[model samples]
Each structure stands twice: as C-alpha cells, then as structure tokens.
Target: MSRMKIALAGIGKIARDAHVPALMASDAFELVAAVTRHEPPEGARGFRSISEMKAALPDVAAVSICTPPRGRLQLIAEAFDAGLDVMIEKPPAATLSEARQFADMAARAGCVLFVTWHSRAAAAVEPAKEWLRGKEIKRVEVSWKEDIRIWHPGQSWIWEPGLGAFDAGINAFSVLTHILPGALTVEDAELRFPANKDAPIAADIRLAHAHAAPVLAAFDFDQRGPQTWTIDIETDGGRLALSDGASAMSVDGEPVRLDGGPEYHLLYRQFQALLEDRRSDADLRPFELVADCFLLGRRKLVAPFEDF
Candidate 1:
C-alpha cells in the first residue's frame, strides 16, 4: 500500500517529543510538511499556515494537529477545508461543545477524524481491561501527581481559564473510562486554584457509577520530587494496579508483561487503521468526565504557583 502523505500542525514540545518521532517511524504515513510559524523539524517542510501547506502539498491527505486546545477548532476547520483527515491530541478541545463539533464537521466533509487519548493507548490498559471483565470492583483510587515545571515548563496556556490540573488528570479519566466496565459520574469534587492563575492547581474528585465502584482521584501539579501516576483498583478477584501512566501493571502483586513499545506509536497505528476503514474515532467520554469535574466541583483558593 502507498504511504499517505501527511502534514503536522503545531511545532511545539509534544509535536517534537512524540508526534514527529512516531510519524517518522510509522510505516503507514509520510511526514512531508509542517504547519507552523516557527521552524519545523529537521527534514519536513515548514509553512506559516495550514493554507500554505495545503496549497504547496495538495497531495497531503491527512494532518495531525499537536497544538494546544485553546483555538484548535479553527485549525481543525481549516484542515477539513483543505480536504484532509484529522488527528487531534488529548483533551480534544477547550470545551466539550467544541470537541463535539469535530465529528459533525468531519462527517460533513467526509473526512476521517480521530481524537486520541494517549494514555488509553498504553500497553497495560487493554490487559487491565481484560482482567477486570466480570469482576466486582470494590473501589478505585488514582494518584496522578506531577510537576508542571518538569512537564509543561513555561506553557502559559495550561493555566488559562479552561485547563489546569485537569489537563493532565484527563489522561487518568481517559484510561479509566476505557478500561472500566461502565461510565462514571462525578458525585462531588474539591478544586484548588492557584491565587494568581485562573485554573486549578489541584483537585480531589469523587466519582461513582451506577453498577461499578466508587472512584477517588487526587490530581496535583505542584509535586517537587518523584512524580506519581498510579491507579489502584480493588476488585473481588484481587488488587490491580497500574503505574507509570499505564505502561506497567501488576495484578495481585504480580507484574504483568506489557507489549506495546510507545503509546504514540500505537496511537498512530490506530489512526492509520481508521483512515483505511474511512471511519472516525472520537470518544468524548473522557472529556465529559473532565467537564463534569469543573461543573460540579467546589472551588478553593491556594497559594500562587510560581514554578515558571
């Protein structure tokens, strides 16, 4: 099969760290151009805007958007107008309403759209899901604490009005929504916002399901030392734990082997399959969970965050 000519939008940290490497290593797509105001990666051509990239490389059938979710709806609309399949990063849009429009636009344009949750693509996620089948889950506890200085550094957009600790916490929600048996509803939550920032720096969310277990999630972006991303689930069968962002797992104190090498690589593979089948894969449940946190969670003021 011929490789699909593709362009990458946004030349930020994530595009360089994950998307570019995955696209370069992918067998299904060719990275030909980049839509960025700044310099693109070493080999790919760079354009000031998506319009220029589309005009220059009309054969490019797909575009992978790695930009922040603040103004991503416009970028996606431009991609669709250019007649390209779209693949978006996690936490699809700034709001659930904007996220929901991707599918509608894609369907109108007859283009394939994929909104990815990278954590759910981790190796241990599927195996954990398989193990949890037909088991009675007693409770779920998530500790997803990380340093914003290390991960996002000086990204001011993260602390903007629409995102905060939930930016990263949504990954945990995504994995949980994917691996669990049923949908979760937020019961109550306590959100702590930095005095200087509009978004919250920490959140303690309580979630429940109609038939499944209750979930308690603690999310923080102010950790100084070792980072933690762990999900411990107690089931009738035994205790199941996922750590290191679901790249590693252990069931009842026994480690389970993980097969997928990198989450982004697996992510692109799935996107290729979607393009081949002419299908759109956009699941808003994770985004919805995050939305619910903001909707029903109580607010608290905290000390100003000054890591940047």
Candidate 2:
C-alpha cells in the first residue's frame, strides 16, 4: 500500500515535539512538507504557508494543522478547499461556531477532518474506559496544573483572549467525554485571569450530566512544583484514577501499565485509520464545554504572575 503524503502546518513546539516524530515512526504517513511562518528545524522540508506547500507538493493527501485556536478556521477551510484531509490539534477552533463550519466544509468536500484530542490517545485511557463500562459513576474530578514558563516559555498566543489555559483545559475535558457515561454541560465556573493578561490563568469549573453525575474540573497554569494532570472518578465498583494526563491509570489500589510514547503516535494511527475508512473523526464536545464555560462563567481578576 502506498503511504499517505502529509504536510504539517504551524511547525511550532507541538509540531516539532509530537507530530514530526510520530509521522516519522508511522509507515502509514510520509511527511512530505511543512508550512510555517517560522523556520523549520534541521532536516525538515519547509514552506512559507499551507497554500505554498499545497502548490509545491500537490501529492500531499493530508495536512495536520497545529496552529493556535484563534485563527484555525481559515487554515482548515483552505485545506479543505484544496481537497486535503485535515487534522486539527485540540481545541479545534476558537469557538464552537468555527468548529461547526469546519465540519460542514469537510462534509461538503468529502474529506476526512479529524479534531485530534491527543490525550484520548493515551495508552491507559481505553483500558480505563473499558473497565468503567456498566459501572455506576458517583462523581468525577479533574485537576490539571502546570507552570506555563516551563511548558510554554515565550509563547504569546496563549495569553490572547480566545486562547490560554482553555487549551489544556479542553484536553482534560476531551478525556472526560471519551470515558464518561454521557454528555455534560457546564453548570458553573470561575475563571481567574492575571491582571496583565486577557486570558485566565486558572479556572474552576463544575459540570453535570443529565441525571447521573456531576464533574468538577480545575485548571491552573501557574502551578510551581510537581505539576499535575489527574482525573479521579468515584464509582460503585471502586475508584478509578487517571494520572499524568491519562498516561497512567489505577483502579482501586492496583496500578495499570501502558505503552509509553508521545500521545501523537496513537493519534496519527487513528487519523490514518479514519482516512483509510473514508471516515471523519471530528468531535466538538470538548471544545464546546470549554467555550460554554467561558461564555457563562464568572470572571475574577488575579494578581499578576511572573516567572522568577
């Protein structure tokens, strides 16, 4: 079988650290070109933009967009118009409306459009999901905290009004949507924004299912020591814990082991499968939850944070 030639847009940290290595390891995909305003790192083919890359590498079958959420719709639309299957990174777009637009365009174009939730590809996630089947859920709690200076460094887009901790927060929501019993909507939230920025530095969210359970989610980007990404669920059977952002799982008191690698590898594998089956994998639930939280949540101004 011929490999799918793929181009990567927004060759930033995520593209370099996750997508690039995953594509290199996958026999199903060939990294034909990359589009970025910035320079591609060593040993990588570069194009100034996605349009330029499509013009030069017409054989490229797919494009994975790793750009920030604020401007993703136009890029995905352009890719769809070019008849390229598109895979967008998490928090598919800046708003739920844009995500719907992309879904409609992808349908009209008859191409695969995958909204990648990398955390869903965590090795232990599916197993945990399986274990939760038919179990009665009591409550769900998610806490994801990390130091932005350590993780993002000089990235400025995250501080923009439409971006920020919402990106990582959506990832946690994505995993919840995948493993939980059903859909949920935000009931209440408090977003804490740094005095100097447009976006929130932390968020406390409450979510509820139709009649079954309630979920409490907390996200903090200013955490200083021993960063955390954990989800704990209380069920009639026992307690299910997913730590390290779903990369590690434990049930009751027993630990579950998982194959270790960057989450993008499994994501690409699923993307390839979707392409092969002539299917689309665009799920907007996670993004919708975050957007809803922002729309309805109360806002609080917090003291300015600095890296020291």
Which candidate comes out best when scored by TM-score?
Answer: 1
Model 1 TM-score (2 dp): 0.98
Residue pairs with colliding backbones in model 1 are: none
RMSD of 2: 1.5
Residue 78's lDDT in candidate 2? 84
lDDT (0 to 1) per candidate = 0.91, 0.86
Q: What TM-scores do the predictions have?
A: 0.98, 0.96
Superposition error at 286 for model 1 (Å): 0.8
> How would you encode candidate 2's per-residue C-alpha lDDT over 146-201 as one tens digit per residue?
88888788888878786477777888988988988777889999999888889989
In model 2, pairs of residues that clash are: none
Clashes of each: 0, 0
Ten contiguous residues with the weakest lDDT in model 2: 36-45
